[model samples]
Target chain A: MATGNISHGRILSIQSHVAYGYVGGKAAVFPLQCLGYDVDVINTVNFSNHSGYGRFGGSRASAQELSQIFDIMDQNGLLYPERLLTGYVPGAEATEAVTALAQRLRHRSPKLIYLLDPVLGDSGRLYVSPDVVPIYKNALHLATIITPNWFEVEVLTDTKITDAVSLRQATQVLHQTYHVPHVVISSIPLKSWLLDLLPAHLHPASASASTSEHLACIASSRQGSSSTVYATCFPCLPGYFSGVGDLFSALVLAHFTDEPTTEGETSLSRAVSQAVSKTHAMLVLTHEAAAALPEDERTVTDEELDVREPIRKIRRMRGRELRLIQGQDIIRGTQPIEFRRLQAWDTFWDA
Target chain B: MATGNISHGRILSIQSHVAYGYVGGKAAVFPLQCLGYDVDVINTVNFSNHSGYGRFGGSRASAQELSQIFDIMDQNGLLYPERLLTGYVPGAEATEAVTALAQRLRHRSPKLIYLLDPVLGDSGRLYVSPDVVPIYKNALHLATIITPNWFEVEVLTDTKITDAVSLRQATQVLHQTYHVPHVVISSIPLKSWLLDLLPAHLHPASASASTSEHLACIASSRQGSSSTVYATCFPCLPGYFSGVGDLFSALVLAHFTDEPTTEGETSLSRAVSQAVSKTHAMLVLTHEAAAALPEDERTVTDEELDVREPIRKIRRMRGRELRLIQGQDIIRGTQPIEFRRLQAWDTFWDA
Candidate 1:
């Protein structure tokens, strides 16, 4: 638990590397590192490529094999202080071990951030085996933050969040129901009641009628004195690299646990947001260049995707209060300002 | 069968819509038609994204539900496909139905090019469910051009192809074994084999000494003509995109089925190479862009992914008679070629 101070050693992330870079901790660990969080990953499955190709080395790990690594980590005292982030836990064995690991982490350091990128349905459909959702539901309470897309938010909260109000209602229920105070409903496509109060110029959703439909996406940075300067962004574009949630959570956990000097208003929200922007810029710039190249050159572009793009970089996390940015917010610099003030969402202590 | 010549007809192609666009005929289809093939597609499975995103809606396709579309097509006499291009046949039913359709087409026209992009494995690993590969094996004889990557080729030929000699030998066996004459091994990375025939100069197995040691990827346009000039190139970079096979097949089908006046060469090899260059360009233009965007905007660009981005446009199909490059080649392409050598692989009839 000593790692929880300024220099948190690393985060122990376990995932189903069933597909290559799209899911699991492969995508998550990188951005976390970018935000200064070291991550050690254990892949449950090493696929030739993702399953979508309909041609891959079928699932390789019996949950038992996957757990052996975790068991070793546990034996080595690695899990003690380091946070845990998991995505797409494949079989019953993986599910069983990960849930246990989460508990162990909690017992070891109640402050350990168990961030789960509950990669469930996107655009009204579930991607994981429905059988696994329940297991994921079980891990809900252990997580400090559960970042789900709209469909997942709906599933976790059992509420259909098709609109903004419902989304907020769902975010509340998600945090309330799961007790994971910080809830980020990524890709949520609507404006919220809170954004109405921020400067009309800073409300990004209002400026671009085109961008207003973005699903709700949140990343809280350092806890501050004045207020968590909640910031919000409309994904300037769509089709971002997969596995971004993993990255965002790792970033949030690193910044929060590190006790970084996120001045009052600027908070961890701003710092994480900048991390996200840096990751996004890295992905986007590479992708543009890749797009410029011939197909033969296409390869794994990012360890984690630029989940949110071109959003202003959040730097001064300590004291700056978050203000609403207009849809033109994307045109602004990359800075993470806590944008949303949800009684439901929290980065650290739930109470 | 008579409709094959109809520039615009519902070429009911069966493939998967890579929840995202890693596969299926999504982004590549438009570019293909831009190359000149009227294409209508049916997804065998609707995944959350590419299987690589861990998973989404675990490959759900009841045989009955999958066949409904084809059943309807049967009623409309549209089942008699002039050209059938297939990639990643999901389940037993899809494989059988497509095979049956291809068989019927051959029976009726004997000239129907069932260009099968045998998507089974890559780099010596299988991604398809066990049940699917065997079915594909059975259907291989029904395809004219069996385009397999290095791994799939090895699986089918049972020959460990190392150098150009082995490749040539393997091609013959593949042609003989699968009953197809044209065996296009995409992106062969061996630099020695690729002296003049260059592109995707990706060398899969070269030692570190002056060897890229990257996968040898070949983007080629094959024509069924006397002077077969394969326009082979490597992206000269390292990356992996799953649905690339689907796009390649679509490109080959598009190029050979049309006539043109673009350049000097008049051969199937050149034609296939041209398709490879064009497809490579489209992939290059879209791949990283997709990496940068979310699930949707990946295909649509900041402006437009001009299929005419120098590399994407097919100025002409060389190596036989006519060497003309038309918009149909770039604006609306994606059907079988005018010649018929590759068909030998897809069918067991008189080659």
Candidate 2:
């Protein structure tokens, strides 16, 4: 029974809800429930909105408080996880505890998938602590697949990356150094995309020419064996919003879990590309929803027509109707508009 | 001899840092510093990165740990603050104790300014624990200004707002019910450049595009001061970063001190707006500096460009040289391309 059996075990994700009050975890939980994953999220911190935009409700719980959560999980036998997809683990102590948990999982099951969205720095900068870099270093080996932006890739591997050549070079170094099998570098700002030296697509043009559609997708290459570079760009019509990574991580995990027959199907390149495509589509559709409204009133709600009350509106989408959830992309600004939700897995191939 | 000389005092704040390590007291202290006030911050939470993103670090500090901070402040004679600006006070026990502190501030300084963000939920959403909201409500009556997004405003005021009429209607009830002089209803998707919607202007795309440029300025009117709404928008830009309220509250205390001469100049509307403008400009100029870089490697570091490193990597145009400290904006998302260490008093103007 142990010989190459596709195991259907539990995945416990320890991440923060990158939402203000209603959308992040509150809204996130709905799609999670729809995806058929027994998800128990340890909200490291909950604010009124994502920290990127900078205002939110207060915070509760300390990093030490998370240890208590693990204790509770142990008391209820909930810690028997087959996979631990850690998202935003708050601080040094929590990282230590999580590293210990990774060691524990290695001992407990030996094959638990640890997909880490190394939520640290972005856009050629590290936003957290210098102390955190080392903690994440410990995690690099523990993680089966590590998701980092171009900036973090450089920090982790200490390689100056600029293009596909350098990105793969850094990814290779990262994989070898960290001992993680797969590394996906996201948001690598291309030279072409920089709107007048935008530098990593952080540029805003003097005026909006229908809002340029920029994308940062996932890519990878098989070491010394494959004939291709694993890369895909998932572009979106840009307007700032938070929690894209949280949603992406959830989608990747769901997709991995969805394919019951194969634990490793295709390279990380394909999986992330597909995931990015889906995410980009969802974002586009969200924009269309916003565009349909008065410019000032454009925002998406999981519920229908919240036009009557718009003050407590969400900046991001909270996609309800999981069964309706399809692999079809949400309407992008430029893409075909009829974005239907996932009715079946076939949508992925068809799309 | 004691002819009501404006009471000299200090306030303290404590919170987390995003990219850097342990921005503890700075979250609270820096804001007060902007207002030309002295402060001491007791960091209850210390992490490598903020919890908004997927931070991988530890959090250490307990009630006992917090008490040690208070002990230090007590020993140093910094506890006799005339006002207190509290943001992101984590834990139920801390909430309980803070209520007591709010009460103590009033008792110790008869005219103490207690400005609470009451960060339960913005945009009609709740992010904290079910218990935390109630705890916030308990402390609301003691607040001089309770700044919440529209979502939180509704929950506190129990109003069904659809238009300006309802918003005004809701504002009256909030002031009457909460007894807080000013209620900064944030993220109120409206089309007014008036002074009252300072909080909304702080949010993104919540107002008209034409009116959104002049940030940090207030479109404000006091409670029951309907005729006070002005057509001209105030410009106090650099107030776009996270935890600016924490800073604003600190400034308000100093500006609104019980002095006769400074009283006229230190109007709440004027100081907050001025601080807002300075913060906005700091962040904006930083972005412009970042934009000024060469294409492709526009996201260059000071070390990369062979220029003297701005302390916070953000540059503020201080006379002939660009100064970079830890600059932030009162409004989120509208972060300056760089940071500066300039103060609100250094940049803001009278209404």
Candidate 3:
């Protein structure tokens, strides 16, 4: 791997953009730019805000528009980005368009590191059209890395990830059957029973694992026949936060390189650990900021908001948006918080 | 003025966004984020790249689309941005939409600082339709600050600015007749004849004025009957750089505050000096990066590119795009370079 490419990278990121809040490209673009990458974005949906509020205004980019943008990019030699990131395309046609775009980008730059965040749905609900599922599945083989949350893991692999064992099995299916070189399950809700499913060495201490306060991130890297898995557990912040997954995937691209620096560490695991650490710190900052908002302006947790009243829902959602701008110091690595729990989970993925 | 507002400003910026290079919002957004401002953007034009390349792809957002976005923002209570920045709206209808949006924003947040960049054209060319001129002229009174280059100054105030004296006169018209609170003539071409028109104290040294190596930036702030103008002169690099105005206006918003810090210094003047200094440094860094590219990859000066062949034009344009990502240190103010010479030109505006 070339050191120059890792330090000074160029990425063409296709994602949704909200005019008033941070989500999708809004969440992803700035951190990458701060980390010293030229990120060129094609906005998949131009909304006033994310739909987590139950209502948003703005239209999605059509398949034809995507093709037109790509055509000009190709004509102008703007397709030579070192990385390509795709997230949150709204429709089936647009999904297919993005898949075709990924294929074209890979064809142009054979060494292109394509990080596909298969943004189908999360938390057992499908936010995108059902047709987007097969499209994302078919495009999986083209990805250098795929960052999927627990719900997406179940949706993509046709398996239920109720515990650690099932989650590991689904990730292995992505590595072996789909031929994805790397897989990062972005988050898993670690219930007490689910914690028991992990191997003894990988388990959290009894005092730390008391409630459902901890969530885990698992990463796997496959090089030829050998594959390695690593997991890190961190305490989850209360309340709803949009764009954590987008930010995590973006950080993975920024920190990812196949060159391992020290013993007992793979580059994929190290990158995942760094991304997870930064994301956790940023979320803590965001949570604190949201909590500090005046009582009248504060948002209720996701469980508390009434879904029927869109106006009330949108108002509450505003206070819950991620404070990416405020967390610039952490995103740029000036304030590094190392959440160290990256341990080998190779036992779960026996050859 | 509230310190909390200054440290955590929220801005609604309506500008162009391109998928490939740094221009318009692409040039402005990241730096503001690095400076700790939450910037929400409405992309006026979505293009493959800036039009400097002669031919590019993508469509401009329509007047209806802008209205739709604003309607949703208003409905969702996302309308209370602390700052509103507008640049490069394509047609008359869209310009009106932006003007209406500005009016609504000001009505909601009376303390809102509106920075309007009348992006009419450069040099002597009119890239936008002539119809956009009257709409911009009528909307000048709504801006707290208007940053326009020499050509836009002429087009907006209907006065030809051949030298510093005429430039000052045109800016006064914007301050007096149009009722704009502040004006920043982003650039002035410093020809030897133009140098002769300046008051003695504002003139550069004869040795330094031997050639037209320098350009001038003049800023004026009006408070009732009293208005002060300040001038700073810096050497101009020999290349066509895009988005200097957008970046300048964005920085001015980030730095500007009405409260005077010390004797003989207005907050407006201090902000202008910092913005001009940072812009100059970033341009120097960008020019050096362009020069260091491989010989075949290097672009010729704007005058050297043949307009008849667009393929050659775009190929050359590739190397000339701003290196905003690489210059993140300077943009984020981690590497500060203070370029002094913000002399008070109050003599030009004596009662």
Candidate 4:
């Protein structure tokens, strides 16, 4: 309210709500709000915690319930949100409902930017129902910005990404096939040569050469202009983080919505850069906290690190959650953005 | 995570979550998170917006579903949250489930603090089901802190609060009969005589003589010591505002949990003072925003300002929501707390 003339953008975020841990809406909403967006979250699933803990509690909201909520919003004449973000829709029905909602919202508000986070799975598999892939692919046309990790990209485009060239090709194919103006691949595995080509400071000494690190790439293409792709590689974190993608999507959207595309600065690239920098800072904070845990609580065995669980074993062993609250200052910009921007094309594999 | 020695406290908040408005958990969770607490929220109902717009859509979680969620948390060994909060339980079954959950959590962790916001009604009428009142009364013993408005106090204690003396007596009865150590009467209507007893500067020039204003009071009793009661008065902003109570409860809990009851500062009074100050600032922001709207959008007919609707007409008239995100800096303490602590007893009506 202190902001007199400056209008805070409204974001309607549809995602999961975990009572305990940070995932989906729980992870996304806070950061967006911290960044000064008026965020309205529609949780597709309400659980006691993220399911990564082997056992969890809560219920997935029925599509009918979602429709009812949407209807109510419509009745209240609250249909036109500045932006709409969809994350972690549980099943085919939820996916259909969300897609329909997005399309209707897009029709209602032409400027309503849709940021779709395709949350199928990480690694080379599908954690969600097989039916969800086609639904996501179909929903891609509605999204102004699409954020998918490597595995989701593969699932959506039906292409394997073995190296940098293939990753660029896949991203290109996504733009050509789906007409998505902005594509942000959240975590693409980096090859050894690519890692060696980068600056040494990017990789911490603790990061071993044997393990693959990840690069988050953002690609934007206009109709007549050549496309610009920007990418940044971060040190391979020791643990699996469940809500990092959600956090990234939220931050990117926040930046994009907060600052419009100007002649001097490409808003998409700037947004991605800011988001990656913030996420890297948050991960460093998370890693430091995990490393500081008592020895008895520090190490998690391979068996306990179940692939089925959404969170990583190391996180469970350390604090069993993302350190969102503790690292909030970073999210709010009180802590400076420490991660530097790499030359946009220099890190691009195709270049 | 950056705070090496400080451990962020955890709060399990059970409340309603509106997708498009600030009320219940939607109003509570972000402020607590902004203050650096790791908050887990269980939403009782997921409405599109607050019901104050004459219509709303959402489904309330059944008791069975609530039990299932609790069972999952218990199975995962996550039942020992440092604090538990309950707000806006839609039905008796949900109330019973929450009470049981609180008792079980309290048993698991004896140090667990339960802050119960008895969100039954305000301004002398019951908005919720009548059955919820008895359930709330039965559950009062399980709470460490109970925040209720004047109407709720009267309903719970079966007494009329004509003046400050009666209000104190009612709070004492709550402590004696229900064993609640902390009783915070959120809003007590002040009489004209009481207003004259206060310093003139506390009341703004716009606050007319005929219109009644409210004061927020906190009464705390220790086992062997006499009770300490504190009160602060503010000009009543024109228009109805929902979620103010939920926001107050959250800020109080955040402050109380953040700072222990040390010798130099009474944590209860400090928490109440801070919460009152923050709420007043937010209301001021809300009033400014509402007043800035075009005249056509400014006025809400008296009939439209229904007491059954939890939020204010001004909010609905302008943005159709509370200005929670706009005034978030106050919630995060970046903005200075402006309202000072009034002479605790000068504002007392009986004096």
Each candidate structure's TM-score, on Cα atoms with residue i matched to residue i, is 0.40, 0.42, 0.94, 0.90
**Whole-structure CA lDDT of model 4:** 0.76
B41-148 per-residue lDDT for model 1 (tens digits): 555554433454222332444455445545544433335556777777676776777677677667877777677887776767788766777677777777777678
Local distance difference test scores for all models: 0.49, 0.48, 0.82, 0.76
Name model 1 segments beyond 4 Å from true: A1-7, A18-23, A33-38, A52-54, A58-60, A191-201, A205-209, A212-216, A219-229, A238-240, A258-268, A295-351, B1-351
Every model's DockQ: 0.01, 0.01, 0.54, 0.53
Q: lDDT tens string, model 3, B16-134?
A: 99998888999888878878788989999889899887768887889999899999888888888888889889889999999999988777767889999999999899979999999
Residue A25, candidate 2: Cα error in Å is 4.6
True contacts kept of each: 0.00, 0.00, 0.63, 0.70
Q: Stretches of candidate 3 above 4 Å error?
A: A1-7, A163-165, A205-208, A223-226, A299-309, B1-7, B163-165, B199-201, B205-211, B223-226, B301-309
lDDT per residue as tens, model 3, A98-188 = 9999998888777999999999888889888887898999999989999999899899999998765676678778988899999998988
TM-score of chain B of each: 0.68, 0.64, 0.92, 0.87
Q: Given candidate 4, what's the lDDT at residue B27?
A: 86
> lDDT per residue, candidate 1, A220-323, as tens digits?
32233211324455444333344455545555555554444434334345444543554344344434543544443333323233123211111111001111
Whichever of 2 and 3 has more lDDT, that candidate is 3
Model 2, residue B249: what's the lDDT? 42
Best by DockQ: 3
Off by over 4 Å in 2: A1-9, A18-29, A192-213, A221-229, A257-270, A292-351, B1-351
Fill in the DockQ of model 4: 0.53
When 3 and 4 are scored with DockQ, the better candidate is 3
Q: Relative to the unseen true structure, what is the C-alpha lDDT of residue A138 in candidate 4, on a scale of 0 to 100?
A: 90
